[model samples]
Target: QWNILSDYFLCFLPEKQPVQIRENKRYESIKIVLSSSLSKVKFNFVLYLCENIFDRFLTFFQREEPLIHLLYHELNDLYRNVLLSFLKSDSVQQKSGQDLLNINFEQSALWISDKEIKIGRFDCERTRKLMSSLNFDEKKSFYQDVRKIYITIANYLKKNLLLNNMLLRDLQVLDHSSRTDQSSGDRIIRIARTIPNLLDDREIDKLENEWALYLVELVDRSWYIKDEYIDSNGNIQITHVASFLPAASQLRALRSMHRSCA
Candidate 1:
């Protein structure tokens, strides 16, 4: 049985071709052509692999570490290449082009020293100083590159379904605690009330009504807010007022109430 299985597997293997070569010159010619072709293919494959190895590194880190230090070298190379390409392709005057080309391309090495990583020194103070040292056009070009990086990160998050995960976690965590929900609702209501220009009276009223309904529902369910009472049948009942209105009906009511108050 084992021999039969081995024979079946060997049948699926690719058949090797036998090479036919002459004794002297033809043999040398075949060897040279084969070696050169294989070397070229291997070099190209390795280069491509190295270029894309760090493409997904950002998604793995998830903003927990210092993004600037992690991206500094890669971003420097990217910005330098982009700047050079732009200068080469644009129809600028020769003198201005030369000036742009002459601009010193320096990478930020502030966060690293002697092959060791330095922590706590990569703050906004050092960053502001670095930006202030740049010339006007250089500053503009750097900011353009920064914007492109931001867009790239945002697109990556969207592509990998990370944005939805983050948003869902934020919503669930915020709504997990009754105190958190109440405090957040109160803050929103206060902001709406204090800043009439920010939120009109109608909007304020609508927000307050929605918040009130949410609070009522939360209070009805949360044992911390509402006490439990034993009824005649010995079943436990929450002592808070239950929301009479369904969610959709409550929102509609709130909207109408806001319009009336306005």
Candidate 2:
């Protein structure tokens, strides 16, 4: 059944050109290609097929648990190969004396950076679902493979890319906004607020404390207020070294008020 479906679908692949004119021609073409080693398939073509066709194919076997299980192994193999190709690609390699290229450090990070946090979350959620569906041995095997892939990518980025630091900075700012000064802290807080379930209670508290500490320090600095003047519109404009600091005390008080009320 899988073989018939695979053959039928192979003909539709744009990458496999010379569009087989007859059914026999299509079968023959698919047979020839399938007979050859999977290594013979182009990396980009396989990735394209996986992204476009394989997902749709899964829908057909939704009720067939056994077939779905088998397909998981096959898809895992394809995924590994595609990931290997991506890691080996010229774009991912470090360019001599050049600034790091901005690319996702992981499948999940890519989605998150694109403002699709749910997609990033789904990467882990999907794997967890798969693990739950599998037997012990299968779960162990899958877990090991996933761990290796994550570690490899992380180590590679650590050694070859500065983008990792940038990503770290983004996390720190968003997760611990209170540790940073006013403008950046406020900006991160605003952004973080929009993303529901982006951070847990511990993270939120940590960020709030970091922010409160920063505000306390700002108050101590005395540089919070730099200059004061009246604008042409007759509005009082106070220019501070860090414009966000004035609101910091108010924010701290509000947080305290909320805590007390709670």
Candidate 3:
């Protein structure tokens, strides 16, 4: 089964998520190809495994009271380990100076060098700082394991030139910025710039409502789809909210994908 699953994981790309590999000192300790970089080869491979792992975890998240909280801490531990492994890889060179996982890149000073970058709603400084410093195990706050998954997705997509720009745009507009200012014309430009990067002609033609629905499908496939409930830490209560499967950003990714097709 492991062999078969490994083979299936390899199918997403002939090799792996293909992108220009920039070596990072933080990730220097590890040497496995799939474990490093966002190569599609690694993403889909993990996606296949996470699909089953999350399925086993679904029943716990749906329960009321402390069950949901216990489940989150347990899963958060798992996410942290995955993150630790990724950080030890050579790709972690970008944020060697700080605790990369906690730095929120979009909020960084470098991103706003041009306040003239008026269109995006994201906190460029915060998002960039975070993104650059972001590592795998740092997800102590969010209850959704899928957030780690999409951050993984974002990291993998980082290699494609188109994907790189799309993500930067996301940082510029939404990563740090609140959605309350939806009235600005720059919002449309912010979104529009991302549309072209998501899908090629083929993926667009293959699906309808591709972005939103696809995320539904993606989360459902890779993780246990959760219902509305309270998120927690160990026995400690966090908050009451609907924690759906997958990183919430996946919804945006799907939307980006749909925009490309449209």
lDDT of each: 0.38, 0.41, 0.35
In model 3, the worst 10-residue window by lDDT is: 112-121
Query: Which of 1 and 3 is ahead in lDDT?
Result: 1
Runs in model 3 deviating more than 4 A are 1-158, 161-163, 166-177, 181-185, 190-227, 230-262
Better of 1 and 2 by TM-score: 2
Full candidate order by TM-score, most accurate first: 2, 1, 3
Cα lDDT tens digits for candidate 2, 20-137: 4445775677666654433132222234444543465456456421231123233333333333333433434433212223334455332212111111122334434333444666
Each prediction's Cα RMSD? 19.5, 21.3, 20.6
> Across residues 1-262, which tens digit of lDDT does each residue of candidate 1 receive?
4235333333322233223333456545544544343333333323432343333453544644222212323333333333332233232223222233343323232112211211112322333444455567755554455434433533443344322222222222122243345455655455344433455677667766776666666444453324678899999876432213224533453344335434
Rate residue 14 of model 1 by lDDT.
21
Which structure among the candidates has the greatest lDDT? Answer: 2
lDDT of 2 at 26: 56
In Å, residue 79's CA in model 3 sits off its true spot by 14
The candidate scoring highest on TM-score is 2
Q: Flag regions of model 2 displaced more than 4 Å.
A: 1-23, 38-98, 102-172, 177-262
